[model samples]
Target: MITEFGLSELWEPETRRDPHAFYARVRAAGRPVPQVDPAGNRFWVVARHADVLEGLRHPEIGHQLPGLSHGEGEAERIASRQLISLDPPDHTRLRGLVGRAFTARMTARLEPWIAEVADRLVARARELGSFDGVADLADPLPVNVIAQLVGVPEDDRAMFRAWSATIVSASDWDGSATLAFAAYLDDLAALRRRAPADDLLSELVALEAGGDALDRDELVAMIQLLLIAGQETTVDVIVNGIRLLLTHPEQWRNLRDDPSLADAVVEETLRFRGPVEIVPPRFAFRDLDLAGGVIPAHERVALSLWGANRDPEVFADPDVFDVHRSDVRRHIAFGHGIHFCLGASLGRLEARIMFDRVARELGTLRLAADQGDFRLHHGGLPLTL
Candidate 1:
């Protein structure tokens, strides 16, 4: 039997810095822990690898659940615009269409451009001898790449960055953040309709141009969802991946010495500390037996990607950051099943380009400061990169 614990206590600075230890304690509790968030919504957080996969595979669960929320009373507000907050035929239809535009072939086609962009960024960073990984490399690379991919003009990328940051705030979506982003997206969607271009927005607009296409509201919501979903997580992956490699000199040396190891290096990074600590909340639609317990219908469940990836049952050491781990490919960072992240290919390509350039250009890169306790930003690492 597992002793229940408080969710708020788990959010403390010490826990945030070393959350894996917290996961261990929760796992040792023997079963999935049932808890309520600060907002009073009840949910089960599965902290062990086997349990997490079981929870993920349960058919009764969904991306959006009644009473499941981003934070506080913001469920209604978040649900209003993001496709992630929906389910079934509605979710499938929207996702299917967007998937057509963000296909693996399309994303892979952007690789050369991604490499060119990474080369430019590294050249600029090299001139300074050392630079912040997030600001110099992570933040700009994906933001610019996705911005261009989505058709936001070069000049408006600053606004895209600001809007993306606000929408993904780790805490809550309230006050000015809500109003400003809503207005910005509303206006931007209108602009895309008026002046189409060779970007994702234009494709969406063209879809809307046809009479039986996405409605105005769905179009706006989809745009907001794609922009935030596509950019923020990739930024963390690149920044955190770079931080992980630098901290582990052996891994860094391996990547630098052999350029072909870039792909494995990225997979290892995702396995080690890929961004997004928790997968989006999933709600149980019906009572389901998963790993010996019955999760009641209508209850909420969350799978900890961080915990599952570090699970000893699956990976050998589970804690050490090893690029050469044979089981690195098993990480569930991009999730599994039907709702797997649509942008995984693009995100992978982006990471590959960034790593390839880093290895080729910045030979023997080192962190300017000794790595400190990584504070969670947007619910993931904000290691000063």
Candidate 2:
């Protein structure tokens, strides 16, 4: 039998095209499965919805693998403090600080601007007759929105994009890209301090919550997280959602007829083809029981968001892409517990507006290439449309 990791199959480009069927097999097993990584590290995969939830909230599981990076450099140490890589206390404090900067009110305020961006992209697509949704609309939308939030100048978005792409590269193992990114953030931080602006990064710089403020290294990590995460996964969501809708014509027609269903479509798209295939690896801090098995201390645990979202026990007709899926909201596409995505509201807002504008402004969207031709970024979602 294929290991659950094989089901995820990060390496085989063809397998990345559709890992759902493999995830379905894991779900059919109805329990956690152990697997190995390319680095020869062993890990457990929690595939069932209930098990994934249990593991996510398990106190003994944490983001760090002391076994893996016990002697790593300072850059790696600072990265461990990032929101995604932290557990409680620190995670709680940092989450509150960053969350305040991205309140629903602030996201609501961004609607008009986000809508304008979508409109402009759709208008360009109209001009070209047929365009790859990735380049024309999906990729640039979130990048520009995040750039605006970070106070990056309009003249510098391209340069910022290059810096972000390099820093986010899957091959950046030596931490050189990380050091370069930190250097850029250092310069940007000095500039922001000298002349602050009405932007998210400025708010982050001045952010003080629970009597604690982010230090310079923490600030760099936070900005790095926001830039790559704020833009990349969001871009995947938009591109994947569009690819799903275009391929599933009936669902697309259903959404087009009832634009109110755009919200539902977005939810369903997330469940069916969420941007992140699996949650970041969590280490078992101590021996712990999980879904009919024991995970030894210091072992790694990987949660399959893809598997949980489509578990047959939870969702009816789990494989079908239904726009009006009633149980769609139950999907942990944005994740669960305290570590849920802080930028979810912004992602949803961007997606809803883009879908609406496409319905109104875009003439017709056709997939420019075969689904297999679309490249998956380091086991993340497809990036071509």
The models' CA-based lDDT, in order, is 0.74, 0.77
The model with the greatest lDDT is: 2
**CA-only RMSD, every prediction:** 3.3, 3.2
> On residues 260-303, what C-alpha lDDT tens digit does candidate 2 reach at each position?
77788778878987877788888899988887678889988888
**Can you give the TM-score per candidate against the true fold?**
0.88, 0.91
lDDT of 1 by residue, 1-385 (tens): 4475766656667777788887777677766667677788777767777887777766678866666544543334544545566677777788877776666766766788888888889888888766677777777888888887877778888987887787677443354554555566667768878877667867776776565466655665676666777788788778777778888888889888887788888888787787767777777888866644666888777678888888888899988988788898889888877667878888888888888888898875876666565433333322222
Candidate 2 clash pair list: none
Q: Quick one: best TM-score, which candidate? A: 2
- Candidate 2's displacement at residue 158, Å, is 1.4
- Kindly report which residue stretches of model 1 are placed more than 4 angstroms away from their true locations once superposed: 1-8, 63-78, 170-195, 375-385
